[model samples]
Target: MPSSPARPLHLAGTSPVHALPPEVKIVAAFVAVFAIVATPREAIWAFAAYLAILVVVWRIAGISARRLAPRMLIELPFVVLAVLLPFAEGGERVTVWGLSLSVPGLLAAWNILVKGTLGVLVSLTLAATTPVRALPGGLSRLHLPGIVVTVITLMLRYVDLLVAELDRMRIARIARGDDPRALHQIGAAARGVGGVFLRSYERGERVHLAMLSRGFTGTVPLATAPARPRDWTLALLPAGGAVAVAVAAWWV
Candidate 1:
């Protein structure tokens, strides 16, 4: 079989996770994140449960940890900042490796790290399984403002075109011996970006005209129907688990 084109780092196969209606997954993801966010900073077990939920989803989606490892590194900066919170936090201090660290700060850091990591992992899982095109439709079905969905739709559709145009421009500049690494090349790069924007704007206008010629309506038609019960069940499972974990964390 012919291989599929390389998708964006955040997008992949049409597994069950991907096949679930976009709106369902979106809502489920939001609920899971909300549960994580609402859990107390000291709720270590709750975060662990959240992580477990993510791991299960990962398995269901057939997305290996190895495949996700590189992308997960994107959270490193936030994690680093969270790690520093312990040292900067106020109140009682604890000695660790010969340095005084605030107890509250340590807990705060732990909270941020665990919550943030799980959130990122959840988001990554969703994006990896879901097609980019389905996202706007899901948002619209969930009653997101029409204008907001339209903007997101246009951005996603044209972003790659813009990037490709920019790449071509850079290549052309390189052909002319313009050294992109040189400090003086900064202005050239800026100009190249500006050129790409102008070209993209023109392309957008042409596309709009074409659409209007074809009886383009304000709304994009969905390729799929309303979500089924199975979609809801699949989506709700993780969300329900997250909620249960949150409750247990608070009460237990």
Candidate 2:
């Protein structure tokens, strides 16, 4: 039996979030993130409200903080940048614990940290619920260009093949007493990367030829059931709340 294809960042479940159509989830995620970005940085309460909304969704989706926290570490680089901004940026300065920090820079840092974190969380939530196979169908429903959808579909399908090929090459090298990780073996590692690229290019040509012979068009066929009105309403409710919070942020 063949191995199942990898579904990156997805957690298998029978929760309502998983039951929602991919297209609705995509739209909801986008709308919620847009609201987060448009929100005023000083509206701290609004950010809390946005988080609260996510918490409700997480509860429904059966996603725990334990499973999500480690994934959030992917934004560490941005966090580091945000941390440095307070000391490095120039403007009105204030003393905090005898260290001078810029006021505007603090606000800017907060903006980046809060908004970026929310954006990433929204994306992670979407990915956690939606299967990788459903993404092409979602994109098709959204009327993304046929060529773009086809390219994305093919890339997702074959990227694992490339990774497996690289792994095989690594094992072959290791069997011959070559350590690809050593500094002295950097040149060999570079050559191996080049070899992988050449092989991939050739394989792409062969695949394209085969596809053409089979009467392939430029687009991949992605057939998915349309999202029902109730699905859209359920998915967008949180996004609507986000928008309301954003609008009220200006006054509050």
* Top candidate when judged by lDDT against the true structure: 2
lDDT of each: 0.83, 0.89
Error of 1 at 158 (Å): 1.5
Kindly give the number of clashing pairs for every candidate.
1, 0
Q: lDDT tens string, model 1, 135-171?
A: 8888878888876777688888877767677878889
Model 2 alpha-carbon drift over 4 Å, by segment: 1-8, 170-185
The TM-scores of all predictions, comma-separated, are 0.86, 0.89
- Per-residue lDDT for 185-242 in model 2, tens only? 9888789889999988898889888999999887766667899999999999999999
Cα lDDT for residue 120, model 2?
A: 93
